[model samples]
Target: MKTELLEFENKHKLLEPTSTERVATLEAISEYTENFLGNIDTLPAFVNNVSEKAPFIQSINFEEQNTLNEVLKNIRLYIDTPGINPASGGHLGYIPGGGLFYGAVGDYLACITNRYAGVRFASPGAVLLEETVLNWMANLFGYSKNYGGTLTSGGSIANLTAIATARDAINLKAKDYHKAVIYTTQYAHHCLQKSIRILGMDDVQWREIECNNLYQMNVEELEKAINKDLNNGFLPWLLVASAGTTDVGAIDPLQQLSEISKKYNLWFHVDAAYGGFFILTNKGKQLLKGIEQADSIVADPHKGLFIPYGLGAVLIKNKKLLHKTHQYLANYMQDASTEKVDLSPADLSPELSRHFRALRLWLPLKIHGEKPFENYLNEKMQLATYCYQQLSNLPDVEVFNKPELSVFAFRFLHKELPLDKYNEKIQKAVMNDGRVFISSTRLNNCYVLRIAILSFRTHLSTIETALTVLDKSKKIAEDELYQELRNN
Candidate 1:
């Protein structure tokens, strides 16, 4: 038995590499990432039709040990090269956070230390760091010191946490779920709907308040809907507004919505996942004026702050309610109960074994300071305005929703082909061209292209390249349509 234990211990020692081995591994990884970043500008943002039978997938057996270089080579070929190169400045599709290098370094340090951030007693410093970060965000959004939040994996979970907190704060019974009313425009991020289903409140009345031409929630219609629900014996409960919507980057009239929520005795929750950190900028602060009135707000550092993905936040004005909703106790956690200097993240969020996510945001803010982040966000808004102007000036283009932040929709028109079909062909051409990536969404049942310019790496030059790509793609789509017509 002593001999067997020695053998197992020797084998386990392999997991902790020698100092030289660690240095070599780090150098190799650094080299690969340096080369990748050096050529990021020239890389294609989108790569279409990556095969499932690629070598990496075929050679997926993990039984055999592989060298570090070999693994990185496979990662470069199979993982990074095939999909949308989000690190590329040309990634204008869907909201993007340009994956800060400093943040990655912070992640490395956090993983190396393996500090448990979920409980205060486990690692008080880690917990305090997280608390400091959340407090900064809360103050940025104009919340009082009484506010509390937890860093989540991303906006989806943050929004989920907010919804759960709101539900519990109101003392909403499960039996009343059928008659409970929640209000938001159609443009609210779909995560809210998913949250409702996950919480088993699918029967709750989701009133999609009408939007004005600018895609903001029409407050008058919203009030009418609330009154209608009340008259019909429904309990109006929550109002979810968008600081920046997914499709067109529309900001609902937050100030108006807050007033209505207050007047109607509804819990006002703002889904500012895409636009919350924009509060750092002067313009954004002005635009997001009434956000302070929200009972709860969801923000993604991954989106607005240009941190790498996996850092999101939910700030609730009432800390006690947030704790009440998610707090749980187990016999194993009894050790942490005595150390109550501050509320642990595990008490306020559904997660108990959460990653040390605060380090990523903290390191960047400390290293670069807040000024650069603010400048980048402001630059994105300017670039969006420039792009919108350029697109509107084009002869055959129709720009939709002048970017409330840094995202908008547009469509290219062709006389011969149906508008939707023509735009679809143009989108395909753009993807195939692979110089810049843009996404498409349907608005009023019409296919339209979208550009979301939030990446810190994105600049005026990148947007100019996108415009050139659009022009080139338009010609390609037109020729393809003509060729098909002739063939038929």
Candidate 2:
């Protein structure tokens, strides 16, 4: 053997840090962790706006080493420091944006270990851990033995993957996917349209469902459209239902939709990214009654489970369908020595190198247990109802749809101003004040304000603060509206 080869083997003999250094490193990390977790309520004050006041940018500098103690002190300071929030202006408003204790630790350990969970043959242990989490998610939605799925980065990718699976399953028997159609509400998230575009099926018919007064997809409209499509020689490939809509927390009429899917032989998929995990709670389970009948589901632990983002899963009722659609062989990546090499993740997702994302969820569930997560979700449900009650009492505020889950949409009903003008003024006022962050949308050609109670930190007090701010904005907006009327 070459001397260089011998040197490489000798140098690869594990690079573990010394115990004395490890102890010091752990202590430093502990101190930083304490600081990070302690000050959750410390809201930031608006500092200099970068666009208004140009801030200095630092360039690459000379390398320097600090003592571990010094490094820890600086890290503590860095963790505590708050920068201008780009999402909500400079004011120090934050959503519960929860910090899961165990998940963080798991992420740190996974990073240190550098585990690749892409293939069963390369790392069976890592792959098994991920598969276990996927199985757990499948069971959560009442998926049976025939169902299986894969984890993705977030709800968008999960939706994309589910659509891809639907495409593959339908296209297996048919030649022209261009004639295939998808059904979803106009209020459905734009991610669905983006996914269709990505799949090179942009020209395919997208049936925009008509919503009732409550913002739910009208099941009758869906049936009518399905029949019309069939008569016109269009293939109804999928029916996408919303478990919890992004705008106003509107849940589509799932039971009726399920029946329609069964009658029409359409692939039924539920986008439960915001409300799926809440299936653990009584109210949530009740709200999502027909979700169990779905052929596929998209759920985000990041949003509903209160974990940090980068965790989403797609559960399909037919596991073999996923394998049938995505399985492909690569000779170089496979080991020929073993007669059977088990399944690889490359056989599932488009990615060849999957990260150890499962540990983030597994660690949290293991350490804190399921009871706490269930309780947390149940609390959010109550909070959303409380928000509705609070807004109902406000003078000019009109509650749009009573929360189907932890999301609600509403708008101000002004007697003297048109709906659009009043809503525009109100949105501007609330956003400019920077007291609370809320989003707005157009439902039925009318502007509607949307508040989704997603943050675990949101409480009755948060809702109360938002209402008080909304009251102030309403008065200001009313005055502005009257002034405009007078001026005109």
Best by TM-score: 1
Minimal lDDT window, size 10, model 1: 51-60
Evaluate residue 66 in candidate 1 and report its C-alpha lDDT on the 0 to 100 scale: 82
Report the C-alpha displacement of residue 342, candidate 1, in angstroms. 2.2
My TM-score estimates for the predictions, one after another, are: 0.98, 0.85
What TM-score, to 2 decimals, does candidate 1 have?
A: 0.98
The most accurate candidate by lDDT is: 1
lDDT of 1 by residue, 1-488 (tens): 99999999999998999999999999999999999999988989989868787765477687888899888998888888887988888999988766999899989999999999999989989999999899999999999998889999999999999999999998898999999999998889989999999999999999998899999999999999999998999999999999999999889999998999999999999999999988999999999999999999999999998889899999999999899998887898899877554689999999998899999999999999999999999999999999999999978888888998999999987776888878899989999999899989988788999999999999889999999999999989888988988999
| Tens-digit lDDT string for candidate 2 (357-406) | 88888999888888988887887778778878888777877777887777
Clash pairs detected, candidate 2? 44-92
Clashes of each: 0, 1
Give candidate 1 regions above 4 Å deviation.
Answer: 57-60
lDDT of each: 0.92, 0.75
User: Candidate 2: where are CA atoms >4 Å away?
Assistant: 1-33, 44-98, 172-175, 336-342, 417-422, 428-435, 476-488
